[model samples]
Target: MDFVFLEDSEWKSLGEFISTKWRNKKLVILCDENTETYCLPRLLAENPDMLSGTEIISVPPGESSKSLALVEQLTLALNDLRIDRNAGLICLGGGVITDLGGFLASVYKRGIPFINVPTSLLAMIDASVGGKTGVNAGILKNQIGTFNHPEGVFVYPAFLETLPILEKKSAYGEILKHALISSVENWNHLKDIGELDEIGPKEIITSMQVKAEVVQQDFKEGGVRKILNFGHTVGHAIESWSIATSRPLLHGEAVAWGMVVEAELSKSVGLPLEQFVEIEATVRNLFEPIVLKTSDLNDLISLMGADKKNTNEQLGFVLLKNIGNPVFDQFIDSEKVLSSLKKVFEL
Candidate 1:
C-alpha cells in the first residue's frame, strides 16, 4: 500500500525521498554494466545536490550474478565502504539489479531503506514494485529471494529510451497479459495507446496502478495474488528451459508464448472457446508465434515439471473464471496440459 508516482518528473525526487527517508545516510547507487553505461550517469547527474555522499556501484550483469558469491562480495563492499543502517540502496536498472539490490538491502545490517528505479518496461510493471526479490538457485528462478517492501519505487519512462526495442515489445507481453487477465480498462488502454512504439506516461502510470491494486489486495500471493501469475506459471518453466539451452529467451518472450499456450489449455478444460481464440489473436498480432519443434517442446515440458507450483502427481494453476477475473484451481494433469499445448502449436 506504500505507493509513489514513478515518473520522469520524479527522477530527482528520488534523492529528496532518500534524504527524507534516511536522513543524513550515505547513498549506494547500484547498477549493472549496461545500465551503468546507459542510465546511471544521467541518474547521478540529475541530483548532484541530493546524493552528495553517494557511491556508484556496479556488478557484472545477468540472472547468473544473483548468486551467493555475488551477495557475499556486495556485503563485503558495503562493509568496506562503511554503509550502515542509516544509509539507503538505490537500484538503477532492470529486474536483476532490483532483485540483487533488494536482497542485499534486506540482509545488509538487517534491512535498510531501499528505492527501486526500474529502467526497463518489464521491471517498471512487474519486478520493480512487488517486493519479490531473489536470485536463481541452480535451475530454479527466484528460488532464493524475499518479500520485503521497498521504501518507494521510482519508475521513469525516460530511462526506457536506452532499452532495446525487442525488450520493449517483450515487456509489452506482460503488460498485454495484464490487460487480458485484469479488466477491459486495461484492454482499452492498450488498444487506444496510438502506437506500440509509444507507451507514454499514461500507460505507464495506469500499469502501475493496476499492479499496485493487485499487490495490495494480496501482498503474499496467498490468494488473489495468484492472478499476477497468470502467464508466469508456465512462462517461468520456459524461462528455466531457455536458460539451460543456448538460445535463452527474455522473460517477456517466454511469457508471451506461455500466455498463448495456457489460453488454449483453458479452452480444453471447458472454458469458453472464444476467449482462447481472442487471447491467441491478440498475441499473434503483437508477437510472432514461436513454433517449437517436438524436441524443444519436450525440453520445455521437462522444465515445467520442476516448477515450484506443482504438487504431488499433478500441476496447479490460476485459471480464469473469465477474462479480468482469475481463480486458483488445482488438479491440472500434465497430459491434459500437453494435449492443449499440442492444439496451439500443432506440433
Candidate 2:
C-alpha cells in the first residue's frame, strides 16, 4: 500500500510507475463529471505518455452514483471495451468514485488492479487510503462492498483548490474524527481552527497517517480498526435518513454530527463531561448541526439496525473514554440510542 504525495517531482514518479507497471495493460480512468471537468485533463497532461491510450469513463457526480445499477452498466461498458483481468482502473475523483471503482474492480472478472488518484480532501485522507470499498444499498450507506486494497494511492493536494468551500469543510469531519481518536496533541492542533482554509498538508497527512496505522493493525477490522468507525454508526444512519429527504448531507458533515451525539453516549461509560464538551464544541465549531425532527428518530434508528457493525441484533459503537482514547464494540440498548438522538438533535 504505497501512498505518494504527488507534489513537484512526485508526479513524475507516478508517471514512471504507470509506464512500467501498466504499459501492457488496458487502463480506464474512472471519474465523475466534476473530476472529468477539473482533474482529468491535468492528469493526462502530467502523465501524457503513460496514459495516452487510456480510456475515460465519467458518471454523474455525488453519492447517488455509487449504486448497483451503475456497477452493472460500468461492467457492461468494460466488457464492451474488451477489458480483461489484466486491465487496470484509475479512480480519479472523490470518495464516491474511489469506493465505486474499487468495488467494481474487485468484483469484475474476479478482480482487476486499480489505483486511486483522489482529488478531494475527503477521499485523500479517508476513503482512498483504506481498503474498504462499496456502494450504498437503497438508502443505506456502503451496505454492499469489499475489503480490497488498491495498487497505490497518489494524492495531489492541488486538487483541493478546485473544491467548493462546502466540500472542503466536509473533510474536516473525518479529520476531526482522526484527531479525537488518536491523541490529545492532535486534538489541540485541530480544535481551534478558524476556517477550512487553515488546514494544510500537515493536517491532512496527520489524519491519513492515523487511519493508515489503524488499518495496518486491523485490515479486516476484527478489533482495533473498529476505532475508525467512531462516528460512522450514527453518522451513516443520519446520512441515510437525509438521503431520502430534500436536503442531503455530505458524508463527513453527517459524521461530524454523529460524533457530537456519540460523544454524549460516551458519558454513560467513562468519557468525562469536560472531555465530551471539548469534543462537542470542536465539532460544532467546524460544522452546522443538522435539524432532526422527532419523526426522523424512528427512521434513523431503523437505519442503524442495518449497520454491518452490529452483532447479534445489538447496535455496536466506538465510544471515547477520553479524547484519543477510543473503545470499540460497545453495544448499547435501542432505548438509550433513541434518547441520545433525541438529546443531541433536540427532538
Candidate 3:
C-alpha cells in the first residue's frame, strides 16, 4: 500500500491521488461520530476539489461499532446512497472505522477501492497499515475479518492533537509492543519517555514503519507476521473480557497489561530475567494496571480458547526470546498458561 505522511505540502498529494486515480469514482468517507465532528471538515477544506462530492458515513465512536450488525446497517446505507462498484471508500477515523470501512469496501460489490485516513495514533501505526480488516463476533475482538489492503494510507499526525489524553496514552501500548518486537535500539528510544506528549511524529512514523515492514514480509500472517501478535493473544482476551464489563478497557490498555503477562510467559522460553523486568517496568510505567479477579481467570482463558490464533485446541503465542527477538507459534500447555496468568496477576 502507498503511504503518504501528510505534512506541509504533502496534503496536496492526497488530493492528487483522488483527483487523478479516482476522479470519476463515487467517493464516500467513513468515519465515527468523533471524526465526523473533528476531522471531516478539515479534510474537506484541504481537498475540496477532489472530495467535493464525497458522501459521509458516520458510526458512533468506540469498539462497539465493530460488529456485523453495524456492517449490515452500513451496507444498507450505502445501497440507499446508490454507491456502486466504481465507488471509493475513505476510512477516516481510528482502528474501528478503518477496520469496519475496509471490510465493507472489500465485501461490497465484491470489493471496491478504499483508502485509509487514520485520525487516531493507534490507527495510524497499526490498524491502517496492516491490511487486516474485520469486526468483532459478540464480545470477541476481530473474530471475523479479511486480508484486504487499501489503495493508499494517508497519515496526518496533526490529527492526533484532537484526541483526548487517555486516547493518546492508549496508543503507546502498541508503540511499545512494536519496539519490543523490532529491535533493542527502538525499544531503548521508547522506554524512557515519561509522557505521551514526548512522543512526536518521528516516533509515530517509526512504529508505522515497523508494522509496515512486518506486513510486507508476511501479508497473510502465515509466518513472520505472527511476531506482531506478541501482546495480542492475551491482550485480545483481556480486551474481550473488559468489553463485557461495566468498565471497559481500551484496546491499548489491555495490550499494556497483556505485554506484562506475556513477558512473564517469555520466561518459559528462556527470555532473560533482566529483559523481562525492563519490559514489565516500561509497560507498567506507561499504563495503569487492570485489577483482575481470580474469578476472571477462567473467563479470560475461555476467551483465549476461542481466539483464531489457537491450533488444535492448544493456545498459540508469540513470546519474547529477548527484548528485540520474538518466537512465534509457540504452543504452551494450559498448565503453564494458567501459571503465567496467575503469577502475572499475583493471584
Q: Give the winner by lDDT.
A: 2
lDDT of 3 by residue, 200-272 (tens): 8789888999999999999998899999988888998998899778888887888888888888999988899
Per-residue lDDT of model 2, residues 1-347, tens digit only: 35545453348767876778777888999999999999999988877778887999999999899999999999999999999998999999999999999999999999999999899999989999879999999876789999999988888888888999888888888999999999989998887675688888778788988999999999988899999999999999888888788888988899999998899999988899998888877777778778878887877877888443342356789999998999998988767888888988778
In candidate 2, stretches whose alpha carbon ends up further than 4 angstroms from where it belongs are: 4-10, 244-246, 293-299, 306-314
lDDT of each: 0.77, 0.87, 0.87
Could you tell me the lDDT of residue 245 within candidate 2? 80
Q: Candidate 2: global Cα-lDDT? A: 0.87
Better of 1 and 3 by TM-score: 1
- Estimate the TM-score of every prediction: 0.90, 0.89, 0.90
TM-score, cand. 1 vs. native: 0.90
The best-first sequence of candidates by TM-score reads 1, 3, 2
- Candidate 1: minimum summed lDDT over ten consecutive residues — where? 306-315
Model 1 C-alpha RMSD vs. true structure (Å) is 3.0
**Candidate 2, position 35, lDDT:** 100
Model 3: number of backbone collisions:
0
For model 2, what is the error of residue 286's alpha carbon versus the real structure, in angstroms, after optimal superposition?
A: 1.9
